[model samples]
Target: MRCVIAGGGPAGAMLALLLARAGVEVTLLEKHADFLRDFRGDTIHPSTLRVLDEIGLAEAFHRIPHRKAYGLTLVTDTGASRLADLRGLRGGYDYIAFVPQWDFLNLLTAEAAKYPSFRLLMNAEANGLIRDGGTVRGLRYHDKDGEHELRADLTVAADGRGSTLRVAAGLAPVEMGAPMDVVWFRMPREDGDPGETFLRVSTGRLLVAINRETYWQLGYVIPKGGAERLRAAGIEELRHHVGRLLPFLAERVTLLGSFDDVSVLTVALNRLRRWYRPGFLCIGDAAHAMSPVFGVGINLAVQDAVATANLVLKHGPSAVAAVQRRRMFPTVVTQFAQRVAQKRLIAPALEGSLRLTRVPELARIPVINRLTRTFIGNGVRPEHVASR
Candidate 1:
């Protein structure tokens, strides 16, 4: 069987790799010439780590420059409270690896190249579906030369939340509202800076500080659709907020002289009622756009690819719907958790009403802590690679 997968993000790249390894011809299309996009989801949770281990890429993945975060922490005015401790997990892969997403995708593509059946077309953007009656026959894409059509037995849309192919297939994800959008930027890391990555929360402010060894990748959370208003307030306003949340970066806050230095991620939490239609299938953010609450987006996408591959190999092109059936539970569970967090924690925090100072250390409780660790570290129904 032949498959054409769109968008060489985590889902498309991985599904292509697995299918090709099993001797099926597969082509992966990437709109960009390179995977160097900044502020993309960089958290590779243990569930994905275990998948790499199963695929014999775990050691190589570790070889790349990445930081291992053992736990999640919430920093407030009172003190820092541990949220989830990944080390408590049973699997040898206990920590989330914070690797630049480009490096991670490069690793997957490189390994995929070993199989002659795998074809990766860089700068090839899949724009629409090539339909035969009701079934998707292949894809119509554009490259530097011109637009073209490629025929395959199955067409997969792993293009992401704003997926072009998903739109072409007449699929729309049910919009689950998020209370905040994120402004992502960077500042230089200096001596005496806080080492571990943590979430900083204060009255009317929520910021995420990720340690990138040489620099700090910071995400400032603001009210939904508030990017324009924040810009109106001027760059100095952002600088002041960052300095207040992370006192250590007070001096270098001026590095953000303008808003152009940052990127805004409009947070979304939504999923499709149906992830597949005939020969077409949507996976990853195409099927379910995740909230950035737990950083589980990449891992979930990877899991979807793995499950899709296993089912396709067993049931052929007819397995398209099965992929959704197997993945829907986890998608629902994860998104539900994110929505709850948004309502209880993030929404309140952004509104300057989260009583972090008065609230008990909930993470210290055994059951809630274990559940949080498992939810973040392993995810729901973590899939294993099916034997070829």
Candidate 2:
């Protein structure tokens, strides 16, 4: 457990292999050791799906509990539209699958077993980062071990957007937008296909679907910390919110049952000004936190892992060299896309104008529908197989 990982997420787990395979012993630490049964980070994008295939985890990914998804769904106050039947995209991996992220991580955790050089430490909390002349040299972590300073050739902050390492290192992710958290629940299996998915629009409420399941991944469009008040208003108010959005869910709306607390995530994503400094580096949400809207977070995060691993394999000891080695691909893509996604994708929609007027209009535009289809369709591959 010499190569210290500040987080046990995908980036951290995947990084352990890259370092271990390179003969660097890795220690992965997690705040919460067990995966909770909840709805979170479900969409595995086409780009990321390919990365997993290349990493030799395709079978593991498929074996995880999940449902096959084809494309994105758009639902307005009136109706729904389908995008990119995934079976029809070119030069893009052509399929999107909806596996709960917790399950996916569990699968990766099991597969990390192939490498004995890797050690996973669960329930380990990283209190602060250790630095050397402005470079992060190590981490001070506490678990059953109580408190210990673990030394490593490198320290990676694969922690979440609220990264403790980032804070301790005094690096703030540039605020692109704010976290936009959601409260979501799934319906019991429907008799028929849920029909792609839906993005039902209404005042103070937003309902969306989780691909083909009878269940829909629904949300309320409220500011942060609004879930308790929503729950207090009772199920009837929530039901009323759903009824105005889609009549189809009228009978089934009750089936929404009870919604877990609405977790708020700032939708405004931020990328660290510098991804690495000397003996340390950050990856995944630790480096650049993205909004959940486009469902691109997982894909981008895995790509970060692959890129980091590749660089670590190519270079040794020098995180400077590793970062320099990775300078080309992943960093380039991350840099190139950040501004565009911030300005074009999320900002204009969230802050520029009232989202109410635009959502229905956007869903109705044939061009927009075509764009959604094209985006999702690209996730599918020409061979109709996922990358692996």
Candidate 3:
């Protein structure tokens, strides 16, 4: 194979698809047998929608059972405020699509299967890198049968935040520290429930309620390293917290019988100083683990894949550093914005100091409103599908 990509994520899957479409032999390794993991980053932003349009998959993506969010709303103790209105965005795809990550990945991989040069190895876990002196030859992975080494001209790691291949390549990301972690759980949704997804902020608690049609996939944000304290307080305490946050769900909060119903996400914000080493490159969560502030993780990873495929197909594996150079600015800008929100908004809210009275007015301001819409809708330096 010319290229071997570890991790069948947005980055690796999309890159493999593009390379195969351009007649390059690419093999993609996915440890999981299927893409059915829940509580993952599911927001597909406008920039990604535009890329799908370019690649002729926009209509197909829209076919999936998903919800369209035109704007993000912040509900505080006082009132709800508009964060970013996507209706004013330029592209036809102004709204963000909330589709299950599995559905999205399945769509991409299925499309890639059309190309003869593409190969997907399910249940193949890339455990280490295949090194040839200072360069990476490919990777060593294990499947159900046994351990095997897959050699190729280039190796790309899109494995995720806890990427084993990145560790094998002797690269570490700088930990930038997040102020909060999230406990995710689901509660039943009713006919009269709030329809739009919104972020709710109270004195010392922050919760996000995403309308997942039948159920509300909620994330209760707590202070960093606060999961232990939360569990110690007991599951009923968590039920009380949920009841206090969303009164409509008070009756159903009891459904959370124990901590087993919730998944704790230890938020980490970090990025690799250098994203490539010789024939190896790291992208997506492997390169930068993003905070779930604006829910831009999936979009940014797709953007990285688009940029990587455009460069690599045009200039071959020698363009590895150029991919990082092209993508680093957007990564830095997005992470900086997330860090700012963590410090100014989330941290204070968790500390019972910040108020949202000014947020509504500030969001209405022309300059800030326009910037917020552009930032959330298109992101920084959004990439397009380059024609081969």
Per-candidate Cα lDDT values, in order, are: 0.93, 0.63, 0.92
- Report the lDDT of model 1 for residue 54: 87
| Each candidate structure's count of clashing pairs | 0, 21, 0
Residue 325, model 2: lDDT of 45
Please state the error at residue 354 of candidate 2 in Å: 6.2
Model 3 spans with C-alpha error above 4 angstroms? none
Q: Over 4 Å off in model 2, which ranges?
A: 90-92, 202-205, 212-214, 223-232, 255-268, 320-388
What is the total number of backbone clashes in candidate 3? 0
Better of 2 and 3 by lDDT: 3
Q: lDDT (0-100) at residue 377 of candidate 1?
A: 92
- Candidate 1 vs candidate 2, TM-score winner: 1
Supply candidate 3's per-residue lDDT for 295.
95
Models 1 onward score TM values of: 0.98, 0.80, 0.98
lDDT of 2 at 165: 84
Q: Give residue 224's error in model 2 in angstroms.
A: 5.1
As a whole number from 0 to 100, the lDDT of residue 381 in candidate 2 is: 22
Q: Residue pairs in steric clash, candidate 3?
A: none
